[model samples]
Target: MSDTDDLVEIEQLLARYAVSMTRGDVDRVLAVFTPDGAYSAFGDTYPLDEFPALISAAPKGLFLVGTPVIELAEDGATAAGTQPLCFVEHAQHGMRIGYYNDTYVRTPDGWRLRTRAMTFIRRSGDHDSGRPHAFTRS
Candidate 1:
């Protein structure tokens, strides 16, 4: 695929991720990642197999993903990006603002997330305490 095509596909992939998460479809969300992909948030790492349980245990929310800054690799097989996000939890009546740092790789199926690390910058509402506390990995 050409550079333009790659960019469009990558953007669509990111959008799908947000939509899937908002819809609470763990399977669909996982589809955006590679088999060995991982998501790190609050300093904890979740592998693909464990991700669904994590999502299921979390409160449902509205996920808004901002435009990502995608950089294609020179070899055309890998890419990386970062995107700001706002998450509003219905149960908690609060919102968290953060950014996701992502690594992408071209696979036989398509471009997939190799890893995603999220850093929360702010929070407010029922959970208010100024900024949210970061979780430490055990």
Candidate 2:
């Protein structure tokens, strides 16, 4: 595929991830990641399998508005991107803001996320988050 084609595909992949997460569609979210994918954020490491459980714990009626900026590799086999996330929760907690740095790989299944490191930019409520740990490379 051409570079432009790959970039477009990468953007779609990133947007799908944001929408899936916003809707709490765990299966769809998992589909984006590699089976052995790692989520490194706030100095903690989590497996792709554990994400569903974690996200499920979030308060109900929460929505995330994400804007993603994608960068595709020359080989089209890898990609990297950043997405700023803004959350709207119906509960008293109000809004939350965060950023995600992601890495992706193109497999027979199409494009899948290899890693996602999320960083909290700001939040309406006081939340506890540690410093960023490992950085991601496409």
Candidate 3:
């Protein structure tokens, strides 16, 4: 694949990662990562296998509504980007906002996440309020 093609594939892989996480699809989320993939957020870092509980406990109906800015290296080895996550409160339609900085790598199996550092810029309503919610990811 050309560099552009590799970039596109990496973006898609990152998008899938976001979707899987937002939808609380732990298995699929983990599949988007390399064997030693790492996720760090809120001063906490853990391996892919140790992240299911965190993903599962996240709010449902979550969505990522925005285009990601992706950057690819010439060798098609490392691709990184920041996805401005528009955190829409699922139930309330548009009640919250946030973003995540994501990074990926092109592996033999395709593109997989190497790291995902989430920064909750601003938020409203408890993400895990146990109340209804709606949202998507990109």
Candidate 4:
């Protein structure tokens, strides 16, 4: 596939991630990542194997994902980008805005997340009530 194709696929992968997380579909969310993938947020890192439990422990909410500025590697097997996200926590009655720094790999199944590091920019309303701590970008 061309670079453009890769970029589109990667963006779609990120979208799927947001949708899955919003729906609290831990399985689908995990599918978007590679077997050894890692997710970092609020100063904690969770490996793929432990991700499901972590996600399941969180409150359900609406997660809106913005388009990312993707940069494809020359070899076309790797890519990186930063995407803005808005999360509305129903249980907590709050919202958190953040950005995800992502690394993607062209796996046999398609583009998968290798690593995703999230940094929150703002939080409002019962923000501290959620399992994930409120954070600000430094």
Which is the leading candidate under lDDT?
A: 1
Models 1 onward score TM values of: 0.86, 0.78, 0.76, 0.85
Give per-residue CA lDDT, model 4, range 1-138, as digits (tens): 887788888988998999999888889999999999998875677789878777866667999889999988888788889998888998776887878889999988999999998777744533222245433322
lDDT per residue for candidate 1 within 1-138, as digits (tens), equals 998899888889999999999999888999999999998875567788878877876668899998999999999999999988898998876887778989999999899999998877743323221223343223
Best-to-worst lDDT order: 1, 4, 2, 3
Judged by whole-model lDDT over C-alpha atoms, candidate 1 comes out at 0.83
Candidate structures ordered by TM-score, highest first = 1, 4, 2, 3
User: What C-alpha lDDT does candidate 3 achieve relative to the native structure?
Assistant: 0.69
Model 3: per-residue lDDT, tens digit, 26-74? 8888998888888766456667777786665555666665677788877
Number of clashing pairs, model 2? Answer: 0
Model 2 residue 69 CA deviation (Å) reads 2.3
Superposed by TM-score, candidate 4 places the C-alpha of residue 108 at a distance from the truth, in angstroms, of 1.0
Question: Ten residues in a row with the worst lDDT in model 3?
Answer: 129-138
True lDDT of residue 21, candidate 4: 96
By the TM-score metric, which is better: model 1 or model 3? 1
The number of clashing residue pairs in each candidate reads 0, 0, 11, 0
